[model samples]
Target: MQINGSVALVSGANRGIGRSFVEALLARGAAKVYAGARQPERLADLVDAGKGRLVPLKLDITQPADIAAAAGRCRDVTLLVNNAGINLQAGLIAAHDLAAARAEMETNYFGPLAMCRAFAPILQGNGGGAVINMLSILARVNLPMYGSLSASKAAALSLTQGVRAELATHGTLVVAVMPGAVDTEMERNFPPPKLAPAEAARAALDAVEQGAEEVYPGDMASGMSQGLAADAKAVEKDLAKYLPA
Candidate 1:
């Protein structure tokens, strides 16, 4: 569905790519946008900038009550942007504990899944709206440097595929937006050549308008995706080198 008149809900709208998504959606003429954040007070600036079209939703995708409230109130939402996630920069076993790994899965995997489930009926009611899941190239290949994060995103990618198949009959466009390392605080320690959050958001919105199911927003991500297509083992081995000391 086109964004010009769509109602969009973007999780983790307080900062990073989620913030960019809200701005991009508004620029694309979305009728309304629900900016969901665990701390809605942190969205004061965004709410102010949005004038009247941005609605601040106190939503913590990890919380059932929050998800339920958002779904009930934002029944008009036609687009769901599952952009909320955390990368604790933890290695699966090297971290000495599983806390970071579990946290990453909760926020990056279960959170999005919960949101998708809560909003599926709403999107269906709204004439088969669209869903844009913000993923990473890490979804396809593990970067042991950020092993747990890679694992969580990989799970999310699977969830995205499953959701796409399930919602196909409803005409809901489920999009997996994969970008290279993004230049967000979340990736501050990551190397250069990172794609800007705004650029990724624009590319994703463009994909939505174009009715694309899967999109690689940056050159690095696009190239890596192709590499995986041609030689999965080679790409896997190459990525394994990123394992931290």
Candidate 2:
């Protein structure tokens, strides 16, 4: 679905790629943009700068109450961006506890799943707009250092596909955005060649407008996707070099 003239809600909009999405949506002429965050106060500057176009909403995607409340409050929303996520640096086997891994799954996998479940009907009522899930290239291939996070993202990726098929009857466009390391606090320690948050956000929106089911927003993601298609084992072995910490 096109972003222009759309009413959009973006989760995790206080900072990182989520914040960038809020900005890009407004710049693209969206009628309204709901900047959702666990702490709505963190979006003060963005709300102010939105000049009445941006609405700050309290949203902790992991909470059922928050998801329901957000759906009730932002009923006019046509575009839902499920961008809220966490990377706890958890490894599947090497981590001291499963707590961190479970936390990652809650925020990264189930959170978005809940958001989509809550928003699907809203989108259908509003002419079946779109839902964008901010996934990662790692969803297709595990990174041993962040194995748990990768596994959670893979679950999200699978969820994205299933939701796409289910939502098609309603004409809702569900797009999966898979990008490599982005230059956000989430990947601050990662090596160079990271995509800027703004660039990644813009590309994802572009994909939505273009009716793309899946988007690889960066060179790294695009290359990796191609490599995985050609030789999955080779790509997995290459990624294995970055062992768990």
Candidate 3:
């Protein structure tokens, strides 16, 4: 499905990669973009920036009522971007926050799953649209800081594949967009040398326009992907060097 002139919905669109997605969609000529966030007020700037191209929708992916209401309201939606997620609260396998881990799963893993389930039918009814899930290369690698995030994204990758197969008949385009540390609020305090959100968003849109099933965006993502395919154990060992001591 071409992004140009499509009715698109992007969750977590208030900041970071989601915000970049909203901008990219407008640039690609999307007819209308329903930008979703936990606090719709946060998207005021986007609405103002888009000058009528962006529509704010209040949504909390973990909430069933929110999902149902969004699905109903955006019934004409043809492009769905699941960009909401959370991070690890403690070190890998740390018992410090089992509850936090569970919460991460709800937002990082089950959140996309829920959106897909709710919007799959709408996309089908609209004559086969595209669904893009923002994932991390951490899905293929484990790091101390990414324990919960890695597990969650790996589950989401599986969900993307499974959903793709199941929704094939519906002509739905399910794509998993894997990228490394984006220069966004998520990584603002981490350090330098991160891919800009604008660049990552552009790469993803390019891949989608080319009908790619999976996309690895940016140098970090591409490098990590290649390393994993060549020797995952070696990559794991090497990635350890970059982790904080």
Misplaced by over 4 Å in model 1 are none
Q: At residue 208, give the lDDT of candidate 2.
A: 87
- For residue 46, model 1's alpha carbon misses the true position, in angstroms, by 1.3
- Give the per-residue lDDT digits (tens) of candidate 3, residues 126-235: 99989999998988787666676677888899999999999999999888899988888777667768999888888877877888988999888999898889999999
RMSD to native for every prediction? 0.9, 0.7, 1.4
TM-score leader: 2
Better of 1 and 2 by TM-score: 2
All models: lDDT? 0.92, 0.94, 0.87
lDDT of 2 by residue, 169-199 (tens): 9999999999999999999999998999998
lDDT of 3 at 18: 92
Clashing pairs in 1: none
Task: Report how far residue 97 has shifted in candidate 2, in Å.
Answer: 1.4
- The model with the greatest lDDT is 2
User: TM-scores for all candidates?
Assistant: 0.98, 0.99, 0.95
The full ranking of all candidates by TM-score, starting with the best, is: 2, 1, 3
- Local error of candidate 1 at 6, Å? 0.7
Alpha-carbon error at 153 in model 3, in Å?
Answer: 0.8
Residue 58 of model 2 has an lDDT of 97
